[model samples]
Target: MELKEITDHPSYPDAYWAAGDEVFQLMDPLDAKRTLRLRANLNHNLLLHRRLFLADTSILVSPSMFALLHDEELGPGYRQLFRDGSIVTAMRSAANNFSEVAALIIEKRNFVAEMEEDQIWASARLLDSLSPEIVRTDTRDEMLKIGHDYVLRAEYWAALGIPENVALAMTESVRRKREERNLDTVRQSEFWEYARDDLLTPGEAGTAQQIRAYMSIASLGTMAKGIGIPPIYPAAYGPNVDRIYGTHTPWEHRADRRMKLLEPFDQKDPRRLDEERNIHEIAALLTADQVSKIRDKVEHRKLLKGAQQAIQESGNSAAEILERALEEFRGYLEVGAGEFLVDWEGGGRRSLLWETKTGQLMRQFSSGAVGTAAMIPGVGPALGTALTLFGWRRAAKLEKWREGFREVTQEAINDPTIIPELRTDEVIELSLFGEIPYSFMALGGDAEEQD
Candidate 1:
């Protein structure tokens, strides 16, 4: 292939050339102006080095534009809390980034009306705003959002283990060849993709969105090239994007990470065989339905058997194996939760749901693999809600609660002593029920199942 084929022409940093100029122009960090060459360069940096080089100090960040505006400190840095509650810390580059990010706040306050779609326009209006100004004197931080977050995202990808250059190249390749024109793509791609997508939607789809995640993801590059977007709709039928997105959820993370085609940062391949095996072995235990959800899309399963065998030979119980695998897999979900969040009730439930999914995942691949994670734990709010729980007990409790709750319903009649009129909820909806069981009463207790 020509250099231009692999590395987008002229943009030394970009990995591939794009199909359309209009979309590429829109990608400019300035949002208002860009050249085909600049777009390609930005694309190259994002894909190769995963770096976003700002030649123009005019870039600024609008505070009102961010989700964590209230939580973020406008220092010389860009940071975020991780999916697991860890902090994603980044220092301000000499490229005159964050200060400009700060100044962009004011300028973009009226940014909402600028979006193409009504939903997107409304969203831009809602974001935190930066008081932006024209660059005066050698102002490094005059505030203009860079046209690229590939660099930041590339660092994140490498830190997570994909090759830095590979990420850069892949990003450029897709960018040059295609144009991501929707919110869903951003959520799954890098930070910039997410930011750009987020900029267009004022009100998020909550947990239930309207995008078909798995199929959309599959279409991004090679995986979905001819596959066409899956009828991700539940049972391949639904108008809600979230249902389709939901269908994509399980395989999406694995597939995204599995497509870890990036060259290792050090030139040597950083293929995580052990990690790959863990996923397949884990998948083996999932049900056929679950396996079907991911089997075709995530190609790394075949590559994981050796590592899975090695891990299996270690005598670690299925749960132990899954835990280790999840530690490595966590970033793909890439859902942000704040650090120092002591309550698992929210994030905790989500985590448990993830684990339970693994367990089901184990069973989904093959019945033989089902028992593998059995020794692990169950899922749901009961087991996940706790701060101190782990091991078989946590799983056991989750299973018991799930089993019980599945069959539970509101009692037919209110108790005589539990007067409906006198009760007002000082706490949970449990108050609405008036008389509550002592066990489900406390958050600590509700977080787990009683023996």
Candidate 2:
């Protein structure tokens, strides 16, 4: 017997025959419209599932949601899902998504610390919940090796329309540039005065990079000590620090300070630096008498202490002072030496918030040092320290990416066709196989049955 005839008059069980018959019907021209509609629905379901899965994962790992999962009144439903292994599935999905995103960022060398802040908090919570034995296990290391292998084979640079070699070289160039900047900053810093001979007695070709990393931590320690704040080392330091220091100075104020200090060192555009240089050159053209007369006409500008003074004047307790000082130091690393600038007799500072090109460069160098230190094994755990050191410009990039995800989720929610109503025929067909279509379940079909 021919295949069509056998399928049409099969002696198989009813369930098997029903599945085969559905496939045959799908292939028939008489059922063409239904087949196309089914295909469209399948595509829509896949798209919707992807969007929902991502959103669910984000919410699940969010700090707010993680805290809510402990609530007595509202925790039972989520706890039940955990017991049934749904939460595990969601967490695994989140891990995979994070790994992929991390691989892309590593390949592109566009490290955005704030974008991973939520995930880092989630991972910290998981570690905190685990037993000591589980925490000591090498499962995370093994998983990271697996992720590294997958990234190597995936060739993520291909997606960026660049060759792997070029992408790698670009990453290397950025690393080299950062290292050089860190070295320069260390040499210029007060810490460098004490540690120069130790660092410069180079034993290896990459000694500078090693020293740069060390300087980052040493500088942090020095800064903390200078402010009379004892260093606190928690397994997950970032979120804890944020909660403690958040009340002292707003992130907006810190960000504004960072921008003012680092704006002249912007690598993407050299116009600002050039414009400043031109102004200095024009000043040099003026005679000494003329420059002295112009300086006399300018208003005297006193250095603004701002947050530093506010923290000191708050009259808080010892512990409170330490916390505020740590927060202040965090801001200082971001702005560098410009955090304390003085007006000179020869130069009339016109701007109320005056930071020279030299000051901006110093800020960049200091940032490089602190950022390098944050990557060390145990030094910088606080999120605020890492975020401040890494630069606030990345926050803008993160917001843009988040807005795109929000738009996609909104579009999916608004589209009626993406999750169509289940018809009786479809329900009966799916039920024959001892299964219910997800669309039906999603549309509250299982709720009534459960009750």
Candidate 3:
């Protein structure tokens, strides 16, 4: 562990992604060698990388002053000396490593996005396992614990005392974790089940957290629509209107563009409302990562049927199978929205909402969404549309409004509600965020009521 005595691993050259003219040194009085040596670098983005170290790397950033070749999100990519030239990237190995680390960081901070959270964490863990000896001293547990949020508070949690920027990066990683969690609660029902023992982060978060997460996502379609666009006006019967005209706010435009990605769905942007839409988007991607494979055409329905059959044939409590299957199937279900009724750990019964990928995959099969989609060609899109956020859009009046409302409804599903069962009508009304305004949705429900 001592600097001089601990020679570089034979696999790599002694020279590494260092930042400055001289090697950076850390005095560790506690250690017998009492010294730590690392490559240091300076970043020109003075405002962002003010600490003369890697604070936060954007996906597009590069490393300078001899830094790791990680992407902007990780810190830096690679650096080259061109006198006054500022470095934009780092070494290939560093870049790859940083990218993995970046994913790990995102996994935890953005808790609502379960899918990507799973994928990124899996990827990060894969990288760590594959390249264990590369950076033997590097702290990878944090990355490993990313998807399972709340691990920062775990008793084993330890900080490696890296550079200030790296330290802060790690710190913010945790801050963002809890912040996003709280953000989830802020948007939905309060009593949502916390992830169970076999299924939670170190944070001790409960069911309310999940409900909030579901609602947060289900609402995204509308939030996306409303976020960066201006208000819109229906193409009225005034002049021969070629295109529908709506005065979109900056947020509205953003939401509008995103919604255009999917047809026949309402787009509501959460940006202007400052509802943390970016987090929502990222969470959606992470959610994709978590259960995307289950959502994939291959397993969605097959597994669901298997689980149902298993429950029926075994004559066992369907609770075990159904409860666990909720995770994957929840997204596939157009059942409006779901809540964490109970937890599997912390002395509570397992949640029927199934938070695991296996469970989710089972739900998809049992729920009839995938099999039906496979059985009939055209029915896939229609089935998906109905089961997704648009569970109530058909009943609405206007064509644009109905489709748009559908978009809004879907986004809200990801974010769970704090209160117990809510009427679908109320949730739909809430989904009309951008199109109809909160006042309309707010009118039906009691603001003070908390279940």
Candidate 4:
């Protein structure tokens, strides 16, 4: 039950624990071995999920994802990805989401039945030891925004026919509590609890339930807590209505604008429901890949332009500029074709393959007789050939990428190391180079129509 006992187990090596001050000092062979193993494990896991999450900045783990990562079967595998590094694993706030998770565990008492009390304690200890980052939002300006969002949400609910008195009371309670506690900001943990306890009489829970239902209908699930459906929603859908709209629109006009944007649709209309689903699927695909693709294109263009200008200004021949451009393109290809191998603890190694849209273009260019023609004296012909072959072999490569993505997606589902967040629908969208098929847009479209 003790921390030392839990960490010292054969399955849990010393490498798993945070290194102490002794690690900074000169170490014997045993200490050296421990540090080396720790470094290797951290590096291996970093490479595993970096491609999937594009977590060059930070990986923000939701409460659900965090708990799932700590589950008995999946814990060890997912923990590998959370190793101490420059790219941190962070929760939104310690006083917010993390506290909610603790509260949930206490409330259920058997939420994770297999997780013994001591194990739970040890898990908390491990989290402390790892020192995963927390996003701070306690500044004065942030608190003002937070307060505004609370009132905005309340006003939205009132617009949807919740009693004006009820809505005012809810917002007023929050304002009163902030003053009473001498707090600038209300953490998510405090806000939700306050809403439930103070929204109505002590025994009345109906108002809180109603508010929750309305929030769900609007695709707003604890916006202050963590990542939700809003991030994946298109800009026109008013995803930033809670925070950004308040800054531009005055309080009086805000409700009308939000109501128009978030107008309720017929839940029973199959066509309407289908359209909503399609929009979400398309949005998720765009969120995951299209933006990245656009950025890559812009960057590629800049690189080519820069290369040409440098060569031309230096009094280089046209061929030299072309050669420089080609070198830049080749470097882009190398970086885009991200192929890495994962060594499994069970013994065998598996490969994770990723290719940018340009990789396919490169393949098509290299395949045709035009590629031979591209060997002319000037670089103009080669550039023309490359551009011409951009859409060539599209169908074949699309199919190949789709199949490969599906296989890796399956591997992700079965393997805990790779988070199973990628969807087949998104893969199909990516395969089409960000195009959503008409069938995908239709109600109850046949599976065969996907091709």
Candidate 5:
């Protein structure tokens, strides 16, 4: 298809596709194939994922930006960034420290240590859900290494807008979308937050244009790394390192430190890599609101399983289950995250009527998750006692309680006036150990049963 004819999604534009088209159209097929080869042995420091590499390779040229920062393979192509005013201005603006955070990002130092404390912690928090700490020290070193590499490469991409000519050729829609998307940039870190604001602010001289240029470069870099290519390392490994060990001389100390930090991660391990990929996949499926609302993995998993079972038991079709469950939890679901710990603690045939009359008891019942509780016998004292006595008792009798809880919950869900305190649109951070520390594990009568 012609470049202008390509408009895959709002995020991906015609100009970007056109650029890829041009690169492929002009290149010699054999040479292109050779350039795209994964030289892991030669580029050991780079991050390479086969799928991302293959996908990006099919779209554009590799080894161009890859070799730009590789000291050993420094070529004339690397100088092209300097010639581009848009890239230079954007990089200068983004790299506020000039010699600190910016330097570390593009250097091999990223694999060794974090560039900023705030950003690292933020990243760690974001990653905690995916790669949970099995042990006290299960810091997910490998995952963090890859994340740092990705962030650093994002910087380089922002600088060059890989395929400079194509970025320069962006359509109006693509350019406008880029500006809008830039606002979603995580503002947790001050540097990035300010950089985004400065670039986007009105009256800033070519800041937005420069950012768009960088975004174009960043997109190409993402495609490269998405498939399997590793992030690029700058040729000049900081002036401090050079001062300690002359410019021509090797920094064995720095190399040793980098090796020490990276020792925890083994990129060669396919299982670990797959696990990491799965983490991303899971994160994608869950919203930030949902992830944040989860109290703990144990509880979340239990609730999730219970929801699936509840949906299945409800006799609803697979297609209708999601809609039904969503309807059931509508107002009860936490804002932004769309999570609602189903509250059936006070569930019983009469509980809903009682809650409707005595708001205090209803408030108490509203606490705790609904998933598993929905199945529990939230019946009257006699039936609850009977179920406790007869362990094999079917949950069919609890349908009344389920209905009662649903009735009351539906009111609150539909009208926030019922429980104004619980209804809010705030978004909070996901819990590392969100499990409620306190729970009603038993319902009394245990002594009689033991006796």
Candidate 6:
């Protein structure tokens, strides 16, 4: 490739090129030649390196905009948060509850209009005396209002990982490209081809690939490429233009460090093999229908292994496991006492029930309640909700509580108040439930045996 092909882009950073020379010098010439160039915006470079097996000589660049924005303290550094798997999570949430979002948009428009009228009336006496300046003043006020609205919207988008400046730039870039190519009327496949082959530079192409791999969305599907929706949506989906305009923040670097801290507990941890083997055997013995219900529950492999180990060591009978799972499933039906709390009960659940999901209860829990969490079996909404509780506890640094909750829940299954309905592999159901019990909290528990 020509030097210009690598260095000509506005997104290309000077430090990246400077760093490249040092990295390249350390590489064997043949390996350097074979190295593939992969550029990502912000801290996504770390993700590319860790996930894609990128060579040291491979050119990795961040947008120059990120470098410029660093002075503002809201630049690429903040952008790294997007790569922390939070943005994608937020967007998925928004997409899942689009109807509620649409309703909110309508409500906000009306609220804004009402506020503007009140403000205008409050300033009417001052406006009446200066008629000539009123026009200019009113126009300026309107522009300021517009700017403020845009900023708020931009912040909302940024929280979903799309920075405002990057979003705007992507909009302009897509508009320019579509007009230049006259791709407005192009078919989906043809537009996708153009987007992949012509619209993006090499760095952008690499970024787009990363976004696709990361998002798991390879194409726009039946969605056409056009100048509609400010063009940025297509560009973001196609060439990853948003990432091309930002950089990573210090916060993102810290997040990466935290992620690294969790690496030692990964699948290869020697202490987890026995538990994993038990889980595997249990999984093989589970009913196919039961397996499908808990598919989304166990995201953390290490955590799941630990939960399995807890259950295996408990020496509980298969009938006891079934009873515990059934009781937990029943708990989910008790609306007010369900497994999910307000903030924890996310997704579409928030819209369905409000009385049981009071903000006060969640606030108390978040403020430091030694809340209960459990590992129980059975299909239905309860399993996912239980897992969500466990996730919140883990995120909140309630490691002891989490382990205790798990142990307590496991023991709770043996309560005579509830009847065991289903008989499946105890380990499989317990694995799906995925929580460690707090045995010490129960009456006959050993205080010294802590997780």
In candidate 6, position 188 carries an lDDT of 20
**CA lDDT, every model vs. true structure:** 0.22, 0.24, 0.23, 0.28, 0.23, 0.23
Instruction: Identify the leading candidate in terms of TM-score.
Output: 4
Q: Model 1 TM-score?
A: 0.18
* Backbone atom clashes (below 3 Å) for every candidate: 60, 3, 121, 0, 25, 13
How far out, in Å, is residue 250 in model 3? 20
The list of candidate 5 runs beyond 4 A from truth reads 1-166, 169-319, 329-451
Candidate 6 per-residue lDDT over residues 1-451, each given as its tens digit = 0011111211100011111221111212222111211111212222111111111111111112212223243333323332222111111112122233233334333111212333333232221222110000012232223223332233422433443464455434544554665643222222233234543665354333332221221111101011010000111111122122111000001211110112111222222222222232222222222332233343222233333343343212322332344334223323322333233334223322212233221121111111112222321113211221111212213455344444534444443211121112221111111111111111122122211
Please give the lDDT score at residue 242 for candidate 2: 26
Candidate 3, residue 388: how far the Cα is off, in Å: 6.6
- Cα error, residue 355 of model 4, in Å, equals 33
Q: TM-scores across all candidates?
A: 0.18, 0.18, 0.18, 0.32, 0.18, 0.20
Evaluated against the true structure, the overall lDDT of model 5 is 0.23
Q: How much does candidate 5 score in TM-score?
A: 0.18
Better of 1 and 2 by lDDT: 2
lDDT at residue 384 of model 4 (Cα atoms): 14
What tens-digit string does per-residue lDDT give for candidate 2 at 17-136? 111112112112333233222222222211111111112123323333343345454344333433332222212221333334334334433221222545544544442332111000
Cα lDDT for residue 349, candidate 3: 30
**Whose lDDT is greatest here?**
4
The parts of candidate 4 lying over 4 Å away from their true place are 1-67, 84-87, 91-121, 131-140, 146-157, 198-451
